[model samples]
Target chain A: MTPLVVGTSAIKRATTPELVFAVVRDALIAHAHDRTTVPPPLHLQFPDADGDCHVKAGWVTDTPGFAVKIATGFYRNPAAGLPTNHGLVCAVSARTGEINAILDDQGLLTAWRTAAAGALATHAMARPGAATLAVFGTGEQARLQVEWLARLRPIDTVLVHGRSKDKTRSLCEAFDALGHHARPALADEAAAADMIITTTPAPTPVLQARHVRAGAHVTGIGTDMPHKNELPPALFARAALIATDDHRQCLDHGDFGHAVRAGVTTDTSDTPVGLLLERPVERPDGAITVADLTGVGALDAALAAAVLRELAS
Target chain B: MTPLVVGTSAIKRATTPELVFAVVRDALIAHAHDRTTVPPPLHLQFPDADGDCHVKAGWVTDTPGFAVKIATGFYRNPAAGLPTNHGLVCAVSARTGEINAILDDQGLLTAWRTAAAGALATHAMARPGAATLAVFGTGEQARLQVEWLARLRPIDTVLVHGRSKDKTRSLCEAFDALGHHARPALADEAAAADMIITTTPAPTPVLQARHVRAGAHVTGIGTDMPHKNELPPALFARAALIATDDHRQCLDHGDFGHAVRAGVTTDTSDTPVGLLLERPVERPDGAITVADLTGVGALDAALAAAVLRELAS
Candidate 1:
């Protein structure tokens, strides 16, 4: 039989953020247990067009199949009145090379996976009894990260920080609709919160060491490309433990690369969140812990496996 | 709008091998003139499962758009009563990153492009008044190679050689139906033909220097993988000139790599077939010339453009 195509709507209906969290969480733990493997993503860049395509693939030994994602980002699409991102994921049997399904996700899965990774990291590293959460950015990832993090933690208020006050106010209003009290705040005000999520494309450091509260847990999901760095080098230096979604990737292209380059850290042996999930790290009550979620391929593969299983049933 | 779907039957009925040859020929000559560009193909292999997937993308500057082909080959598929090869070609707009159409050609386009390339090379490199042709291997390529070459040059007979006698005879009979006088022959007889084409996956050389007739033109299409070599290194030494589909690719993985490794010739600056098309090489009356047609991505892109053009019309 030909490979079935799972469209965006079907993908949305088949799995929730919580469900994705569970699958991704388990896959990470499995990877830490040496049960699955994902290689670094292959990037194709057309700098002249401000376009890029990331080809990611992974396999879980315990699952029925694997997935390869073709994700594109046209940074200049907003000027053309089109969506900034488009993606397709192909599921194939791990035992054989039979392709099972092609998911025309339009970057929805990518968004969900990013948000899900945020939630997973927060669940594993966030301080117990954390209440107020701050978000640094007003983009789609900023919104989804807040939504997913809210479901995983108890927070009745969110501190919004944005380069543009209008977008920040809009984000605050969106947060209010979701039954959370949110208000625009300066970088220092947002950084003082118990939990912080950085989700912007800032070329310079937005979250510095001085602004971070002592007992806070900060998640950085912004600095994906070489030019973007959301957190300052000193921020990583101050954290008692730094966890990256994929330690290997962060060492190469993620936020950790910046820190390594600045001479703040010489070691790439920062704990992988996968390993952290398998063996929880004991943090002191006043220690600042940072989680860098640069994203990984296993999340997509696991979610694709879940969707295909749901469709089959 | 959703991407249009063009299936195998549509691809087959919309164009002929001759049309594909024309489109591919013009594209190659244009590329030779530096009017088109194609990136190197990306290959994903599952060695344990004996499956491989090749991703090829290319575009013509003068054409409307570009194409990316996903071609798969599972060597052990016959054990499960499945075909060994499958493929899909995505036609995409060059201006935007939007995928325009997904052609489910099931490797039909791949086959056509390869055969079309053979015809193009033969047209450019064959000695004047060439007649009898010989094909080694009893596979789809063997049959299609004969068909495409018959259209490019004047030939009244074809000699077939294969490891299996029954399959070789079957190939000859199939050729007979195409109105060509074909008969099973040993390696020496087959090699003595006016032109010889090797279309097999033998790890060792199938066509050695001793077998080839002087002044005969040869085309090698089967040694695409790193481990496969169809023609012996000595055969290259006997040729007056050698041309490859892509000079960059041949130097790395094609038959040229083997010859270079065996110390036959250190110079890799062989002329590209595209250049041969644009400026026909003048070979003395008895000088032999060989062309390596290691199926290129441009051929697929050109044919896809033709198919889309036909569909639009």
Candidate 2:
């Protein structure tokens, strides 16, 4: 039989958040053991045209093939009421170089994989029995992060912080509909939560080091570009340990880039979250942990493989 | 209005050799002028599986678009009467980052583009009114070189030289059907022709430098890998000028690579074929010229845009 060429609808029906989260966790762990080949990501930037397209690819050795994802961000599309972000994924055979399937994921797979990464980070770093969670953005990622993290930990209250009050309230309303308690909170109050996730596209730091309390597990899921940052540079110094999905990628771009540039931390010795997952480390009591995820190719490859398997079954 | 998802049939129906040649030439020119951003090429090598997939992408400023080509080579498929090479092209809007078309060309576009590239080189470096061309291979590329170059130059006689007599005879029959004179000849006899084209995947020098006469314009198109070679190292010393689609790429992984390693040439300042095309050079009679093409991404980008335009019309 020919490889399936599926659309967004098929992918949505084929995968659930829990399955994707597990797949993503395994993929990231594979990165640490050197069981996967993830090439340095590349992109075509159309600065004059107000857009950029990032291309990432990777392959995992065990029961996993390969995948190539092309994700685009058109900063001006929202002005026309069109989608600002979208892309496709191609799953290929590691044995024959045959493209086994092309999932016109339309960026759905990317979103899910990203949220899953956040969940993995939160699970590995957050304090056990922590009841309060805070999200720094009110977008889809913020909502998904809250939902995914809730499943991974025992959470009772959710605090939301955004530049706009109405948008933040809407995010809270989403949690309320899902039978969870959520409310808009001030930036300082949100930073004080036991687990905080920053998913905003802010170009400057929104979370201050002074407000972040002890034993806080903070994950920065936004700031994919060099100019975009969410966490204050000083926060890295305040955290007990800084972890990242792909340390090299984060150091070159995203929040770590700013941190490095600001001389806040010249630490290239940060740990990969994969290593932390492979060998579970009980967090030193009352220690603050920071995770920076700028998205890597392995997670996409794993998610695509999982989705293809789902459709096959 | 929806982005066209086409296969080889549509690509064939929508493009003529001349149109594609023009498109490719324009693209190369755009590359020379630095009007196109051609990212470094990437590949996936499944050594255990005896397969490799090369991925290339670029964007031309004038077209305001981007293109990505995924070309795969599966070495063992020929035993099953299956084509060992296949790939696809995607043309996209740079302004909006929207995928405008998906050309499932099945490697047809790549073959045509390669042949067109040969034509462009021949037209640029071959002596005016050159005839009696010798092609050193019996594969599809060797055959297509004859057809595409015949239109670019005044060729009436073609000398075929391959180790396999049966394959060479069949190649001769192809030219015979086109109302041209083609006959099998010795390596020396072929080298003495006015123009020589080596499209064979020979791992060692096939054309001895002593056999290549003066005033012959030679092109080695088969040796894109470091381990492959078709032209003798000493041949470079005899040529008045060495031109390539991309000088940097050729030096890294083509005939130029072997020649450089052999100490036959330390010349890194070779002119680009586009420069020669832009300013048609009047070659002095009896001057030997060489052109190396290692497949650049700009040509793929331009070809995708051209195909999309044809479909739109």
Candidate 3:
């Protein structure tokens, strides 16, 4: 069997942002429904290293793509010229453990998986025909959120807030190319959108609690590590319902961790993304909803499985 | 840029048991001197499965060859006809994570690495010029043990013990063909040899305290998982000194776990194999010595690195 080399360039060539978003969304839903088998993340700590490495290898056998994936990332000091998060996802044959495809997109899989988590959360929490959206950050993850959210809802306008004017302009241009009504906005304009998506690596809080409007849904995806934060801890106090991709991981490394550390309520019975995806739950009509998408290995396994099946067929 | 495919048949064709022994032994010595970078083992556990699957991937950079190895195995229910242990070792590029070779020798890399571990322990613990040897099991590991032990010591005679007489006789024939005195013997006769190697997957104790003589060095490589045991727990009390590949793993899953659970000792400080390899520790002249060879990911990484360097040159 010839091994398929699905590098970052190949993914860029073969898949559009919209197609990737749709596949990833379906993959997340499939995984959350227990239609996939994703092994626990394997943790590795290099000798004398400041942080740890997380490895998740799994096979999504029932997802039409009998493929196995091995994803590895390093959570270490960024001063080492290595991104604090970088890894490759290898899709393999579930029948033979033969590596079939290698996706060299260092953090692309994480971005897509995070967006899938958002879409999954929105399906459970958002009101029908919810349109206006606000995204903080003009980076890869921010771009992914726009594409993925666009697929799930009919967003007539998008407010993009970024630290850099040039990046915000480029993001606006990209969104325009996608035929969305997008414009650069001040950070406070995030209150005008029905939904807010924050994807930044800032150590300090980028979104304040006062800027969030009532009944607005917020999805935070960047604070997946202990040293990073995207949303203020105060925001959790106002959230009527808080859902997360993986409660255990979120409790340890997500925005929820910061909230819990800051003396916020630790009641997590209803926060698991799996629970929201598996069962029909009531979403209060005018209450603030927040979904912490710290990214889960299961979603990556699910999407890789889907892509492998597609490529195989 | 071509991935090397070293299947079971190919490994059997490309390497003789003798050559594999030598390669593994040299790798162990080279690795002991801090000459390799060994990655931690990667694990995968299917949902609802009783046990986990492990993958050990590594690169031996300084050896004459350039190869990366991925060895896969499982600890699962034995009724599945799956051998409970199945794996392939893929040797890939040192510069790139490209596959160079795939060897499906039923975890031959395990056999080689285990033999190397035994060889390394013998080199560090056995009395200089030790000759007579006794090896348990007539399987591939047993064959490799004999070959590796012979390289460390000039063995004029080797006593073989196994459950089946016909299988032992077949092993004896293979050994005798190599011009050594190899013969099937009763388990008690194993005590007469200066060096004893046990490589069977026996659930209960195969070697007892009374059977091992003074100054004899024992290396047990079979009992790796927590449920497995090859050496009697009482034997650990009698040994003057004990060492292991990785002390924590050994304390958790190896013969040492059994010993510790049985209240053999309160302290395990002197048990790390790295201690024995790094320093010239004092061993009582006529005291019994024991070395537990539960495998470690570091050794796989070490060997893979060496093999890769060798292939490159």
Candidate 4:
């Protein structure tokens, strides 16, 4: 069968915040309930080009189609006036294995799915009435996490932290334009916020356990690669609860893996974020919660299937 | 940059047997010389649909672009008036990780490459002037094997062996149209031919060692998956020289693996087909040679790149 070639414009028109969040949430729950099949992702590194590509495929039992997504990141692309990321998702019929649609979303779907996952994990684990937020990156994810989470909870303040002063200031201004009281802050200052999300690709810890305030929730969006770490190992030891989008993936390359390898927490200590989303975990007074997300393919599949359905309608 | 979306017709227009053979040969040699980077392929099985999809990506050091190919086989599709296989290849700039072209060949390139590899292996390992050819399946590969091999060598007799009488007859007719003496043959009769190429996805051996004649060469092409075995394990034991494309992959999932697992051959007994292509292994009088091809990603990448270049020009 000839597949419908849906371009970025059509995909953007079909995508809604509600749709992304709902699909991502259901995908995570399905994964946690063991109803999804996600094979280990294929990662290709182009060190000479300062780029990497990830090929992820997933099948949810309830979805009509499976998605195989190719997402690439060229760290130096911005300097060449190109986007740092590019990708397309191929949706195939689960019954016939015939590709039905090529969603050339150009990495937008991945970004949206990631943001929704981070927001869901943060909202599910963070204490209620958490208003202040800290975002430790000046990239698309940092802005996305803060904005998407604001859809779930009230964010009265946003603390932006990054090594680049210019980019950090620009991100803070972007958040300010979104009507949140935003300003640049040091790592320690940002870590003290009520909700913290680390989105930097720092090879070393960006925040220490001692700097985070009590009753704070920290969601890690970076550290998807083995060489990346954004949270200190001691941070896991100080947490009241730890959660992960994918247990195996997060334990292999996520910050939780680093903490586990450092003996900060046992491998089995972290709970699946989907479980917490289904049945909210009790948050004690003055407790800290951490969520590690290394990304999951099931969310991509569900979101792609949902978007294709939306486009078809 | 906008990627060129070349459909099946365009792909077909650009593809030629000579181009396929040249690119595939270079890819094999590059792989043998460690001049290509091929990550482990991603395989997903959908038993409910009687389908499986394989995602393979590779980059040759000398190539300007890389390719990620998705090939799916739905064995039951033919009953629904659909082809049993479907696939596409995405070619990306290796220097930038930006997808530059999508060759929607719909599995044609894969079939051609497979056919080319089989013929190359058959010609490389078979005794000089070996003309009698026995193909153990009447599928596309079966026809292509006989035809492509005819391009490399003079085949005086073509033996088609398949379960379906009609298919076997049809294949023989096709070979007759191509001006070759073709007829149906049983296991023992076919195995006694100068060269044998097995193309059936049989879970058990299609031919036994005792049936194969001395000095005959066999190229097994269908035992790519772990559970599939096209050649008898004892067949490897009787062979004087064994060759394989991608030693690691062949040793893990190819017919070579079956032989090793069954204690018929040691793991180190098989030589890389690429090495044999570069320096032909001496064949003793009345000695048998066997080749196991599991399919390599580098060939896909190289072939895709060549096709894209052809389309552009």
Q: What residue pairs clash in candidate 1, if any at all?
A: none
Tens-digit per-residue lDDT, A1-313, candidate 2:
2335688888899999879978998989888777787777767788786888888888776554788887889989999877888677878777666778778887889888898889888888888767889999888899999888877877789999998999998989999888778999999999999889999889889879889988888999998878789998888887788898887789878787778788888758477888887666678888888999999888888899888888889
Question: Which run of 10 residues does model 1 chain B get worst, by summed lDDT?
Answer: B92-101
- From the highest DockQ down, the ranking of the candidates is 4, 2, 1, 3
Q: Across residues A54-89, which tens digit of lDDT does each residue of candidate 1 receive?
A: 667776765767777776677888899988777677
Write the residue-wise lDDT of candidate 3 on A145-235 in tens digits. 7887777767788899999999999999999999899999887887557888888877888888888877788888878668888888788
lDDT for A217 in candidate 3 is 83
lDDT of each: 0.80, 0.83, 0.66, 0.90
In order, the first chain's TM-score in every candidate is 0.95, 0.94, 0.79, 0.98
Docking class of 1: acceptable
The sequence of per-residue lDDT tens digits that candidate 4 reaches over residues A136-238 is 9999999999999999988999999999999999998899999999999998899999999999899999988999998999999999899999999999999
Candidates ranked by TM-score: 4, 2, 1, 3
What DockQ, between 0 and 1, does each candidate earn? 0.25, 0.47, 0.20, 0.69
* lDDT by residue for model 3 (B1-313), tens: 2234444554444554455555554444554455545454555544344444565543333432232234333334345555545545544333322344544446666777787678768767887767778888887889888887676667788899999999999999988987789999888898657888888878998777788888888888888667679888787888888887656667776787788788875446336665676556577888888888777665565444444444455
TM-score of each: 0.87, 0.90, 0.79, 0.97
* Top candidate, metric DockQ: 4
List, residue by residue over B1-313, the lDDT tens digit for candidate 1. 4456777777888988768888888877776666666666666566676877666777676465667776778888889888888767777655556767778887888888888888778767888788889898999999998898778776789999999999998888899999999999988888888888889987888866887877889999898878888888898888788988877777677887788788887656477788888766798887778887677776777888889888888
In the predicted model 2, the residue pairs found to clash are none
Query: Which window of 10 residues has the lowest lDDT sum in candidate 3 chain A?
Result: A63-72
Could you give the fnat of all candidates in order? 0.09, 0.43, 0.03, 0.63
